[model samples]
Target chain A: MSKDKWNDEEIGHWLKSVPKPEDNRSRDDILARLKADPRLRDKQPSRSRKWIPAGVAAAALLAAGILIPSLMDGGGEVSVSDSASESADDAAQTTSESFQSGRSIEQNSAASDEEMSLRSDQSVMEKGLMGAAVYPEAMEGFVPFRIGLVHEATVVPVTFLIPESVVAEDFGSVSPGDAELYNRYASQIDEEALGFDDYHPYQGTVSTDKGGVTLVLSGDHPYDTASASITTFAESVQETFRNEENVLVRDESGAPAEFDQVGALPEIATEPEGVYFAYEKNDGTTVLAPDRRFDPAHAAEAIELMKSRTTDLFEPLIPAEADLIVELPAEGDRMTIRFEEPFDFSRMDDQDAARMIDGIALTAAQYHLRVRLQNAVNPPAGYQLEDVLPLPAGPNGIILSLPG
Target chain B: MDESVFHRIYEEYHQDVYRFLIYLTKDRMLSEDLLHEVYVRVLKSFGNFQGKSSERTWLFSIARNVAFDHFRRSSVRRKRTDESFDWETEQPADRGLTPEEAAVHGDDMDRLFKVLDDCTEDQRMVLIMRFLQELSIAETAEVLGWTEAKVKTTQHRAVKKARELLEGMDGWGGGGR
Candidate 1:
């Protein structure tokens, strides 16, 4: 047997030489395995069912053949994908991709035919995510949050939905400090207020650079009209936000001490509604007001000043109106704002813009709606929100940047 | 091609796969379990395979990975490492000489196998796949993702080492040829 680069004759001989099993009993045994494991028959196109017969063919060859052929039973070099099963175990330790690569099924010594069959009968969903699923009903009683980053390290206000009958004491597991603060401010919360069902306090983080405050509502009512009462309450809160004074919830420690006031805009208007003052200083920036008693006139003035600013800096860089549209095709839950024009964000520094962008994002959380701000064209130079986000450009926008 | 085709494939390949596992892991039960697991996986992913390499080379590669993976997942490994043998627990040697292992037949072959065990896994694999498995140079190279030069060089070293081991054996390959 000369071996000179394995000619056609050698390959054919090699192919024909592999051993075939001597009995039909083994074939019957494997078929019984297939019958037992219904997963093999569950889907025909999948590799599981597809290769069973191929395996049987290889088995048949060995059972019937006289020669040992190659000590290895593999017919040829299997491609990576074909060999995926062999490496499935290794895949877990190697590349993340191969965990699902069940190309080869090793025979089991401890596995009973019954166990194999039962596994195949089980649905994939039954297996669950990493073996466990988060219960949906539990989510109902808990506050739903999509907590994420706000500017460098600050977190957006965490909104809480307080049930009408609940008092600060009913809040189980709430930190003692929070309990103390709630107790100190108990008088402000009207337990019997009619619109208390949807009462929520807009809670934001507080620190030297960033601090948090909560906009709370107080009231108490019976269990009878909870659902409808809650819905109406939510609407009333929104209406109050739009038409009343600019709410301010001040942290006990006050704003960050290091702010360098470049200039002070007059003391916030007496009847400020939508307008909230935010100051930037050397240490970091802080929002002037969070949730406070509503003032419609002051809000109108602040919103007017904010709307008049320009954003031409990074026009092309900003996501276009077509792209920025959230929950496309007219899904109703949205924070609708009519912009004067499309904003050009190109002018503002990227980092500052990201910061300013957080303001709009924070606003969105409060409203529980997706907000987008469009920028105006031919905007004034240096008329950008400093240390925050760039002005947005588009029709019907919600600007996140500070008033220029 | 058909059910019969698969039946033939399994019967033919199962033992070879088992043998490969046995040799690689040196654990009979682990090798059997992995052999079945490899076949099951092969059945599942067979359709995705494109005919780039021969099925045999592909199968061995699979067996190799399965064995390695089993090695990783087994908690038994920690026990093996922890349970060190005490030198005092040895049986007294028998006075008489024992016959050569019937499996190897020749003393030289037995020495060669011992030397094969002493070789690095990579060297052992190259030699086994080449001489024992009788894979072509190109085939072995493809299976291990090694260049042909590396496989040949390693094979040379392995055989040389085996010869060195053989020289110390009693028969010594018929009195050193």
Candidate 2:
């Protein structure tokens, strides 16, 4: 045996030091330990509303809304097709003309301010809550928290919720294949508040001299296309509006209403006052109630309060003791529960996965909490835990608010 | 065979399983724990054992996969925890050298581990079974579901790469092998 090599001797010495097996513990004990440790069960992806943009990007591409095709290839950077700029302008003009015609706006060059205001009000009334009327002032408040969006470029409805306060800034022709249009929309929203289950309010569309996209506002999910109305403006206005601060309150009719209220249901704590409450069963998967008027500066503080206050209500029924620290950038927390000295996931089939996902989802739903399926950030298998349901464009997970 | 066949097999071959793990990880306690795990696995799959490789070879192969899986999981956890745990530090040094000299020789092994870790599970399995487990080229081919010629060619490349690493060093073994 060579001294330098890791021959049988070195290995034998190391093996002798390991713990002796008792063979005493029953199978149930091992299973119990595993079940009690969330870390042991390969972590399913955490769900969040952040993925709405990506979903929207996919949806837009699928909807034939924009026909941008992949340009990059195996070679170096793709050269911009010279026809891109001219064709893009042409496409923008066509989309604008169609949208304007659909809304039946007059082609007159000189419309009175009163007429414009009356048309804006009429547009809001036509879509009802399906439209979010964003004014110029209301949009200014939410701009700082805006993150861009990713949506299916094809299916992305060209509609948006404009608080009555927003003023359009500039209306210029778009570069036909600019990928950032969706990205810009996604990045500009408060993702935590407007995730898979919540509405992601957008800043007004980049208007153009071709024909400006109109802002429709009343209080509701921004992706509610049926509620939006289009308009053409010779000059663009910067849209601004206040973010809805109250939870949604419903009238006797049971449709989601736009109003300021004390809270949602009487069972949970009261929804804060002065804020408008809008309750929605986001695409039939998650129920969320977001305040259209949130102040971004207070969001982190608000998140902490909500997390601590609702901890007990949303705790799991099986009561696991694994470390539950939310993952930070580089910190590592791991838990490994043994399975009778022979762990085999190959035996676990789809039925097992469904049962596990269902149990977790049902337990979460009890507290009115919706778990958004986030892909595994890292692990044994990097896989998406759940498919994002195809929704027109809305937040993806359960939305909740704190009591005043 | 009856369940007692598995119990008897475990009693007879548990040490060989432990020894196989020891060669792979070079950590005695970890190897023992893994050895026990292998036997437990064998106990579960005893009925499925079709006698393809001899009982000993089959047990060794299972032990190898388990050890490899453990290392992969450990390294992933370590990486996630410290974003900077260098896996090169875990390699063993070469013999026939003093402590300081061995450290220098250890660099080759470090690069070897890095290359091995980066390989796909299928490729890595073939490499380890041949060199580290000291399996014959044919034995490695059988265990990994590969042809004998493929195993030989891959092992030759693996050895050449290891020699290349050694050649890059000062006072190295050169490429005589």
What is the lDDT of every predicted structure here? 0.34, 0.31
lDDT by residue (tens digit), candidate 1, A1-404: 22223443433343234332122236566556444432234333323321222212111000000111111132222112222223222222221222133221121111221211212222221100010001121122222221111211111122221211222244456532332333333223221111111122223321111222233322222111212122222222332232223223232344321111112111111121222223221122222222221222222222333322111111121223312322311554444333445555546543233333433433333333344454433222222222222122111110010001
Model 2, range A1-404, lDDT digits (tens) per residue?
11223333443332233332223334444334323322123223433443322212111110012111111011121122123234333423433443344321112112222221211111111001111111121122111211122211001111232212221221134332111233344434332222121123433332222222223233432222211111001000111111222212233344433222111221111112111111222121111122211222222222222222111112121113222222111222211122222323234432222222332232232222233333322211111234321111221111111010
In model 1, which runs have C-alpha deviations exceeding 4 angstroms? A1-27, A30-404, B1-5, B79-81, B84-113, B171-177
Docking quality (DockQ) for each candidate:
0.01, 0.02
* Chain A superposition TM-score, candidate 2: 0.19
lDDT of 1 at A232: 26
Cα shift from native, residue B100, model 2 (Å) = 19
